[model samples]
Every structure is written in structure tokens, then in C-alpha cells.
Target chain A: MSTTVTQDMSFLYLISSASVLVQLVMLILVLISFFSWWFIFRKLFVIRNEKRKTDDFEDIFWRGVDLNALHQRITSARYDSGSLERIFAAGFGEFNKHPAGSDLDAVMESTRRAMRATYQREMDYLESHLSFLATVGSVSPYIGLLGTVWGIMNSFRSLSSVTQATIAHVAPGIAEALIATAMGLFAAIPAVVAYNRYASSTDQLATRFESFMEELSNVLQRRAAG
Target chain B: MSVSALRNSSYSEPRILLAGALAVLVHLVFIAVLIFGLNWKDQQPEGMMVEIWTELPTPIQESVKTQSPPKQIKPAPEPVKPKPEPERPKPEPVKPEPAKPAPQQAAVTPPVKKPDITIQQKPDPIKEIKPDLERQKKQEQERLKELEKQKELEKKKELEKQKELEKQKELARQKELEKQKELQKQKELAAQQQREQAAKAQREAEAQRAAQQAAARNQITNEISKYKALIQAKIRSRIVMPPDLPGNPIAEFSITLLPGGDILEVRLSRSSGHAVFDNAVERAIHLSKPLPLPPDPALFNEFRNLNITVHYRE
Candidate 1:
């Protein structure tokens, strides 16, 4: 059994050594394909939950609820992935830290800083693995093309010894080469589509966070001044 | 915290990790299978066979006849001696009748008498005569030495003949070498002459090209000077100063005119601090219509869309 395993491994090693560039390209494609599927599934769930939480948070926020009560509710839950909730938490925490009747400028500056920090964290979460998705989308096709070029080179090398080259002789190699390309597209197309969709959603959420921070800061400023 | 909520959060990380690991494993297995298939398909024999011989044992390989007893065949016959003279004389009277049959009978008779007598005698004294046979062999050796001396002389003659053939080949080779050298010298001389001729031709061509370029440049310069004068004259005649213009301006004003001698646009390329003076110069250019055209077409081509620089002085 061990010898057979070793034999199989050495056989693979021979193929890899015969065309290292193709093997490397295929390896990279496989890795990208794996990671792409992982991210696609993971992000699908994450982004869906984020959308739901954000919508629920927004609804509650606009329903004439007391700001302090909303802060308590968000703090108690603790795992809120919503962008608006984080922004609100950051601003409210800073607001509570300062003494009552502090100057409006000092209060607003502290709130803005907190909100900015939280905004960065939210954006980081939203953009996680997005760059990997982007890399996969852009590089997979070229990687697949590299495999195709190497396979064609092998085919031509075979032709030097063969008197007659028919479709049967060439087709399997071409088919295997094209499998890499098909897998690459399979990995890339969804990644690209998902990236675009997620990026837009992230941007919209970011805008919402910014606007909420602005409104919250104004409200705090007015309270301090009054 | 709710049990359902806590369970969901806890399970998410493991679920994601498991899914990621499974995906990676699947892809790795797929790649491994692909590579294995490719290798199995492409495998080819690489080594060649070499033959080697082994010797059999010497004793066993020897002929079996060498170990067996010797066997003998019957002795060969000897030649018949001529009959004695007495017998020949007696047979002469009967010979005519027998002579015709004698030749035919001689043809049929086998000469086996010598070996027959040796086989019959078996003499011990004749066995002792073998010692004399050795002495007779020494005498034969002397005869062979004389023959060898004659053969040596013949070999010397043959060596001379080989030497003559070698000398002829050497002479032919020398002639061939001389012929090749002569041909090479002729080729070199012809090549040298051709190179000198080509150089001379190239020098003449270069000189002709330089002379043509000089003439062309001179013609162009003369044409440019004529056109410059013609353009200056046309401009001086056509340009008109406005009555309201200042006597002195700080800077020179350059105005561009279009084809047909109409002012298409004007700009203060150099701005005068006095805006009114600059404006007046611009107005003067606009008022000047259909400036005088150069009579020569070559001059006109140069002066078309002319840029005029006017300096105002107090």
C-alpha cells in the first residue's frame, strides 16, 4: 500500500516536473477556486445577516425610541454586525464619557473621533476577503491560459515524433487544458459578481453610517449647547 | 442570551472552517487525480538492453576425437617405374599391336605400388634409417635458405616499385597544391581590384551627393531671403495706425492675420500695463481690411497667415 501511494505520488511528480508552469498554474487555479467557493458561501450568509440586522436597527432607530434605551439594547445584544449600530454605539459611548454640560465643540469632536474609528472597523469587516475575490476574478483566466499554453506546447512536442496528428491524439490534452479555464471562469465569474454586489452594499452602508454620525453629532451638539 | 442565538453564533465559525477545509481538500484531490492521469498516459520506457557473452569451460569445449584412439585408412599407391631396356627391346616387335592398347591400358591402371610395398615390408633396419632422414632434413634446410635469398631479392625489387608509385603520388599532390595556390592568388588579386573599383565608385557618388545638397541648400536660402523682403513690403503697405492710438506704448504687440489678408483674431501677446493703448492697437488691426497681397505666389505662400510685431514709440 505504501509503495503504491509512493508510486502514485511519484507519477504526479513526473507530470509536474514535465510541465512545471502548467502544474503551477493549475495549482493556483485550484487554490483560487477553493477560496472563491469558501468566500462565496461565507459572505453570502454574512452579508445577508448584516442586511437584516441593519434594516432592523434602522427601523428601531426611527420609531421614536429613546436614544439611551436603544444604546442599552445594542450593548446587551453585543454581536450586532449592523454598521449603524456600531456607529451609534461609538458615538453614544464617547458622549457618555464626557462630563455633562461640556462645551459643544469638545463633545462633538470626541463623538466624531469615536464614530470615525468605528466606521473604519465596519469598513474593514465589509471589505474582508474582498481583495482575494478581486485577485481571483482578475488572475484566474490568465493562470488558466498559462496552463493552456503549456498543454499546447506538450502537444506540439508530441507532434515531432508522430507522423499523423488526429483529433483523438490532441483532444484529451486540449480538454484537460480547457478544464482549467472552465474552472477558472467558474471561480472568477461569481467572485466578480459577488464583489460588485457586496462592494455596492458596503458603500451604501458606509454612507448610511456617515450620515448617521453627522446627525448624531448634531443632536449631541444641540443637547450640550442647550 | 437566548439558547438558539448562542448556538447559532458558536456554530458559524466551525461551520465556515469545515466548509473551507472540505473545499480545499476537494480541489486538491481533483488536481492530484488530473496529474496522476496525465502521468499514466505519458509514461514511456527509457532504458535499452545490452548483450554480453559468457565463455564455456575450456576442457568441456575441446573435441571428443582428441581423447579417442587413432584410426588409419589404407595406404596410397605409388607410381610405376619405366621397363628395362632389354625388356623394352624384346617387346618392340610386339609393341606395334600393343602400343595402341598400351596408352589406353595406362590410362586405366592405378599407381598404388609404393604404399603397398611399405605396408608389406615392415623392416626394422628401415626404421633405423629415420636417423638418416633427420640428416637429409638439414640438407633440405640449406636448399630452402638459397630459395629465401632469391625471394629477398625479388622483395627488394617490389619495394622499389612501391617507392616509385609513392613518389609519383607525392608529385601529383605537389602539383595539385601549386594549382590551388595559384587559383587562390588569382582570386585574391581579382577581389582586391574589385574592392578598389567599388571604393572609387562610392567616393564619386558621395561627392556628387554632397555637391547636389550644397546647391539645394543655397537655392533654399536665396528663396527664403527673397520671400522675407516681399513679406515685409506687403505688410508695411497694408498696416494702418488708428488716430486715437497712444504715441508710445511700453511693449511690442504681435497680431496674427488670416489668409486673404483679413484680421481673423488679435491677442496682446505682450500685455501693455496701459489697457487702453493695447485695446487701441487691437482695434486698429480689426479696422484694417484686406491687407495688400504679395504679388509673387512664393512670397504669398510664406506671408499667408502672417504674424506682425508692431512697436509703438513716442
Candidate 2:
């Protein structure tokens, strides 16, 4: 009977046996995953509300209500106005600032400038922390890979101390190292998928906002000529 | 930038942290379920074993004249599995052994008697031919004398010839008795030698058998300890010790094992006094089911009921 004194190796054992560098890598990956998931869920609500707000504001905008009356009503409930409604407000507000019988081209240009500014600000808000999701999606896998490589390296380094090496000697090391990669992918995959979905939906909203800006600019231009 | 940062609703730390805690809770629950589920599967005991018994030793003599010696030590094929019964009548090798001496007495007797018959026949042909020649000569002489002399002379000669014939019969009887005595001595010598050889062979066979029995016993102990160590190794790996226990607590168990290494029962013969500590050790053994066992059924008797003491600290 060979007296091979094997210590109990479980998931806990794997973590306990990990080298310092690899352990740090695992800790970092865990935090990254945790934070990424937080942003992912938070962004889910933000994007959904943006879409609903855009849709609701567009329905009223297309009802052909008087511009002055629509602007006044929305200005009173300005906090509730979506990107589309805000854009409309900015354009009409700038148009009212122009004196009656002013140069029509200059008036339309001023209105266009105000509408463009609101569109940029709204797009910035829509796109904020989206980069954070993208960063998490693309970087977490690499962080996990870094942990795996370090763990395996430490595992190999342990082999140098072992005079007689068997698979059991290094199996725990490799398994522990691979867990880092698994966690990384767990954090990255959903982030990547959500980022793709949200980015596309935001682009759809952006396209609609741009088209509304053009339509509103054309209406104001005609009103100026009349 | 500070005023704007305060203005950004999306970057609120409290809201993000609450979201993170919820997300982490979901993921942690999912992982815990998977890991614990996998653990239950691993804990199942599916180990297997088959008992083996080597051939009993042969003392190196075959009594049967026709068969070769190769078959002498071939082990008997294993009988049906005697399941459920934990005990069997042990076939202790020390019992009465079938005699194994080859019969040499029948081959030795004939040559001892043949010489006596050959010696008696050598003088018989010569004695018969000489008498016949002598009688022919005497008969010719008597014929001539009968013409020349009276009948009384011939009668006297006849009595003398009869007496000489009686003497010759007495001599042959004495010779036959001598030859019989010589054959008897030779038979006795052959029998004595046969007895000596048989005694020597018996002594050798007995010595060889004693040596074989000793060897078999040694092999059995070595095998038992080897398996004991193997089982301990497997069980030790499965053990999950309770943390922060005081002293080096030791627990002892009396385990009943089947021939195939399946643990029939494990009784806590002595507890470590710490219930959780004792429980962990028991669970370890349960997980290490179908413990490693000796392959020989003969050896299984040693392990059939065994006492194992597992030390918690060590």
C-alpha cells in the first residue's frame, strides 16, 4: 500500500490552493462581472423608457396639433417630454424668439441649430454607460484569460517542486484556473448580447429623431414663407 | 463637471449598487444550485469488486499414473456467488489432505521371485538326462547277466537301483528348500527398501506442505493490509472535517463489507464526542462506498467484519 497523503480537493480547496497572482486575477474578474451585470440591468430600464417615451411623444407630434399650443403644453410638462418632444420644443421656442417679418432663412437656421443641440444632448444620454457595457463585454473575457494563464503557470511552477508528478498533482490547479475563464464568459456574454440589442434600438430611435428634425424644419420653413 | 455629475440620474451609485446586489444574488443562486447539484451526484457510491482465490499449494506428487502434473495446481473454478450470507465455512488448509504417494510396491515384487524359479530349473534338466543314460547302460548289462546267471542276482541289483533313486529325490528336495529361503530373504529386502523410500517421501511432502501453508498465510495478511490502506486513502480524500474543533478527535467504526467491497453496514463503535465531527467522518465513508477489498475470497474473511478508526485531526 502506497502512503500517498492526499488533501481533500474541492472547489474550496481549489480557491485556497491558488497562487497569489492568480487569486488576485480571480478577485478582479469577479468584481468586473458583478459590476457589469449591475450596469447591464440598469441600462435595460433606461433604454426601454427611452423607446416608450419616443413612441408616445411621436404619436402626439404626428396628430397635427397647432405647434404653438403643443409647445406650450409640453413646456409646462417639460420633464415628461421625450427626446422627440424636446427637439420640437427647442425648434419652436427658437422660432418664437425671432421677430415677426424677420429674414425667413435666418429664422429657420436658428431653429435648426436649437433642434440639433437638443438631439445631440438626448443621443448623449441614450449612449451613456453603453460604452461601459461594451467595455465589460469585450474586456472581461481577456481578464478571465489572464487569470487562467496565471493559474496554469502557477500550476506548472508547482510541478517543479514535485519529484514524482501525476495528473492529480496538477488537476486541481487547472480546474481552479479554468473557473476564472468561466466566470469571465458568464459576465461578458450577456453584456455583449444586451449591448448589441440596446445599441440597435437606440439607433432606430436616433433615426426617427433625425427624420422628425428634418420634417419639423421643413414645416417651420414653410410657415416662415407664408 | 461636478454639477453635471450630480445632475446625471443614470450614474447614481445607490441605484447601481442595488441593481448589482440583485444581479449578483441571482447569479450566485444559480451557481450554488449547480455546484451543490453536482456534489450530490459525486457522492453516490458506485464502486465495484470481484473476489479471487488462488489455487491451494500442491506437495509435488501425483498418485494417479495416467494424468500429467500440469493439472495438479490448477485452481477450481469459482462457485456461484454466495450473496447475503456474510459468513462461510472456512476451508482451513490445515485439514486432512488426500495422500499423494505414487504406488511403487506392485512394480518391485516380481523380480525378487523370478531368480528362485530359474535356479531350480538349471539342475533339473541335467539330473533327468544323466539318469536316463545310466539306466540304459544298466539295462544292457542286466540282459547279458540274465543269460549267464540266475534270477536272484538280478533281483539284488534292482533293489540297489531303487535305493539310489530315492536318494536323488531327497537331494532335489533339499535344493528346492534352499532356493525358497533365498527368495524369501530377497523379498524382505525389497519390502524394507520400499518402506524407507515411502517414509522419506512422506517427510518431504509434509515439509513442503507446511512451508506452503505459511506462505499462503503471509500472502493473505499482506493482501489485507494493502486493501485496508487503499480504502483509507479513498475515504480520507472524501472526508470534510468540521472547522475549529478542539483537540485531535478520533472516531472508530466497525464496518461490515460484502465480498464485492460494498459496505453492508458502518457502525460508529466509538464517537469523537463532537457530533458534527463524527458525522463528517461517517459521511466521508458513505461517499467512499464499495470500499477497496481483497480480491481473494479466502482473504475476504479478514475484511468481512473490520474495525476502522478514523482520526479527525490527523
Most accurate candidate by lDDT: 2
Superposed by TM-score, candidate 1 places the C-alpha of residue B230 at a distance from the truth, in angstroms, of: 92
Each prediction's TM-score against the native?
Answer: 0.41, 0.48
Q: Which stretches of candidate 2 lie over 4 Å from their true place?
A: A1-7, B1-18, B37-314
Q: What level of docking quality does candidate 1 show? A: incorrect
Cα lDDT tens digits for candidate 1, B16-128: 77657766776677667766765665442111111111222333323332232121111101111122333345434443454455444433322243245334433532564
Candidate 1: fraction of native contacts reproduced: 0.20
Worst ten in a row by lDDT for model 1 chain B: B71-80
DockQ of each: 0.10, 0.12
* Candidate 1 wrongly placed segments (more than 4 Å): A1-21, B1-314
Provide the DockQ value for model 2. 0.12
Model 1 alpha-carbon miss at residue B83, Å: 99
